[model samples]
Target: MFAGIEEVDWASMKHAYGPADDVPALLRGLASADPAERERALDGMYGAVHHQGDVYPCTLACIPFLFELVADPWVPDRGDIVELLTSIGGIDLGSDDEDEIDEDEAEGAANYAMAAAAVSAGAGVFFGLLADEDPGVRLSAPLALAALHDDPARVLALLRARLAAERDEEVRLALVEAAGRLALRHRPLAGPVADWFARLVGDPGPPGLRLAALAQLARCAPHALPGDVVPVVTGLLGQLRTSAAGPGSTRARPVEPPGQGAEAAPLTLRGQLRALSAEETAGRAAPWTADLLRTLHAGLDDRVAERVALLADQLRSPDPWQRVDAVRMSDRLIGGRRGSYAELVRLVGEQLAAPEPRLAESAAQLLAGLSGLAAPAADALAERVAADPADWVRTWPDGRTRLGSAATALARLGDPRVLPALTAALGHPLVPSELGPGVARLGEAALPLAGALRQRLSEAVLDERAYDRVGPVLVALAALRAGAAAPEVLRVLRGAPDAGGERLRTAALRALAAFGPAAGCAVPELRALVRRTGTVEAAEAAGALWAV
Candidate 1:
């Protein structure tokens, strides 16, 4: 259909592709057995012509011709059409009158000029195609509009208008894409642009679409997401927290209620803005730092450690919005130099016993930073960590990557109190990450106890207690030697009963295989364990058997 000037009767073809006249060609392309022929006809008509007025009736003619192809059932690609319109509209296609025109011709020329001027004039014709009955045409239209619509205000207006009237999910999504592009351009638009986004952020149409809209809003105005939108992000944070809590099955509820204003709004517009501002200032000191500090210190006294303790307990709240703000404030209060390190340590120490795993993890990280500044808090933090239950230390409830940050923090503090918990946690499924750092901290302080831990495993081969207790000890022992426990490692493997002993004993043997000749004495038993557990574990052992 779009055969360029040489392939068609340019004068007659002008109206042939117009909406009122298009029929036979569109029907032929739609019914073609060869999909490529249909695709070629569509792409050629939509993509081949660039300078619409250079060889035909003024740019005014492109309005109908382009719309015809745009409305065609076989016009599967909007991007191609967008490129076509963008190329022709971006250049001077020349005036409608060829020479000095009569007064009557001047009106025709003025009508063409009005239709051709403004980026929107070209886009208006394309946007009109969005109203076509065909879904393909509807989907393609906004994309062309997004590509060609240069007037940000008009584009935003068209989007809101379409959004209110649009019933098709696919077209609604196209509107989302259009809005995102406009937002990205950062152009001044109709007042409703922000409101439209705020509405979507508050009640995202679908999960994927909601997240995409939230991310775009965050990118555009990290600190100024409308107050109504905060609940959506806070809701996601709650989902993550609940999943972290434990594996018990509680029936899930709809993420948001069907009606508007159904949940307590998490933050006011000001609070949402401040949170984003703090995030933006993560690496730099914010101007609001002094103000933030004064506000936090308003009712509390510096001399009162109990007041600090109460503040730390707030970290354990079930309300995710509060929890998030609490963590951010803690990072500011404790990490900011305006506060004493002693205060920070005191605050974190109090929070460790708090029931919430997410809060406890935060306290652990804060304590880790404080360890280098004050040694007294180190032992205190270690004691509390060591006293915690083994399972509690095993995995974090939130989607956190590490559960025993407190143990790691304690290790960094050079306190031996954390050794028991660290050693106990070593064989658990998620224990490997905390192992290296903890052992490195244990250093020379752990040598005397290392032998005892090794002997416990050696003495208790037939006992379940030993099976449960020894794997972490083995990991700790190997780590302390800087990979020197091969001989002792081999002896344990030879002695432990496969039926009564646990998977940790086998894992211990494999750990030795990693050090090779550094672990040469354990080579034979490791090979046997490999035969038992198969090549994967055996291979790790095999590599360690010879030092390479």
Candidate 2:
């Protein structure tokens, strides 16, 4: 298939790893009889040839051979090859803002354009692959066509045709996503595509398709999104949960078996260790359908209210995986965005009482970050803490303790009921770093725990790697106005360079400031810090100096 590959002076070209001498061997490996060899080859192609989406001369040269592999039915990983081609062709040209391209970026831009054009020239292959018997190939083709095809109208037509005949749910979703991408890339086609997506959303087909269409519609033509999008999405999520729970249903099925798919990529010793570590650290795996719904929710982007509303329903879902997924989504949305997320917070709080300890722990963790916004969940969080104060010390499968998370949430909401749990956590060998902030939030109500905080701070100051633990303790001390900690706070400020980064230094300085003139011993150090201009530390030090 790679007939003229040898004629090319591969040694003369450069990929991410210098010489492109390995290009041909890698290409050959793509068609190897062994799946491992093929996976290794694809890894090399992406790792070196098109590293981090930067197209190289070797990357452009490998395009034709990649296409040949895609066209060949015998190629076991043709779908993955199609995806690689899409990545090569999908480089953001920054066409919308040509004026922003500087000289340093010009060569990369040119290479990207060349790579994209090369792939687009082979768009005919993808169109044929759209009908390929392999569902993987069929799934990856529409996106390639949408991304690389020069004729938007033809790409749209073929995608619609495929969508009509596509019975595979994954491929059908891909078709809808491709149509959205096509409309977004080619704005002239947006009106019609929005209409088509709207129709899909209203269709009586699987709720997943409708959800996909609704998400895309929110993206490409947000103005076209129906007023009832939240309710519609909520109902669709209910349907999805029902279908996923039904006997013989394939909705929540994993995309690939364990030890396969993207995780199956060849890895270096370090990469393998890191992957194993991540797997061990990650608790229970969520259902595959939860991931799909998360993607759809992400597409809603800045539509906070709608996203929150959808999360409420998801949190209420009977499916544990769906609820778990909702807890994660709530953490991101509520923590990052600004809005009245009371209802969402309340729903998340409801999960704190869930029978599943893991789900309750997840919900508690989410609430812990919300502070005042977590008020609605206060009663539930307090209940968990009161139920078993020792739960704070009891570790979960994910390495988090229940009452620890719940107590943190309660303390953040300014509930003094968590004082016992908070104090108990301080005496534990593995003190929760969050203990400091939660204690700080309670102000004088947390003064009883000041002795424990000071003891932990003393221990933390001795360990250089305990900088994260120290900073919060310093903040808590400052909030409590603990005059007794002024010496330790001064020690931290004086040894800031060895102790930690600017965070610890700032925290120490702020603590000294809270002690007012009682921390007069730190005046000279504070003055020196103030003179180190144009830094956050200097500003914080100046504030401390003024307070002193």
Give me the candidate number with maximum TM-score. Answer: 2
Candidate 1 stretches greater than 4 Å from native: 1-151, 155-183, 186-320, 325-350, 353-357, 365-380, 390-392, 395-403, 423-437, 457-475, 478-487, 490-548
Error of 1 at 518 (Å): 13
**Tens-place lDDT digits, model 1, residues 1-548:** 54342333344544224432232353245334454444444433432222233322433444445545544555544334444554444443254445778886665456444444543454766666666665545655675676556666776777778877776554565676667657655445423455566567667354324444454454444444544433454454344345433212111111111121323323333234434654443432112222222332332334234324434444444543344345555565555434444654554565666665655666666766654653545655766676775533655464222436677677777677766765565435334445545665777777755655555555544444444445555666665663555556666666666556656565565557454456655656655655745545466555555553
- Tens digits of per-residue lDDT for model 2 on 275-317? 5644432433323355556666666778888788788878878
- Name the best candidate (by lDDT): 2
Question: What value does the lDDT take at residue 456 in candidate 1?
Answer: 55
Q: lDDT (0-100) at residue 85 of candidate 2?
A: 94
- Shift in Å, residue 26, candidate 2: 1.5
Tell me, what's the RMSD of every candidate?
18.2, 5.3
lDDT of each: 0.51, 0.79
* Full-model lDDT, candidate 2: 0.79
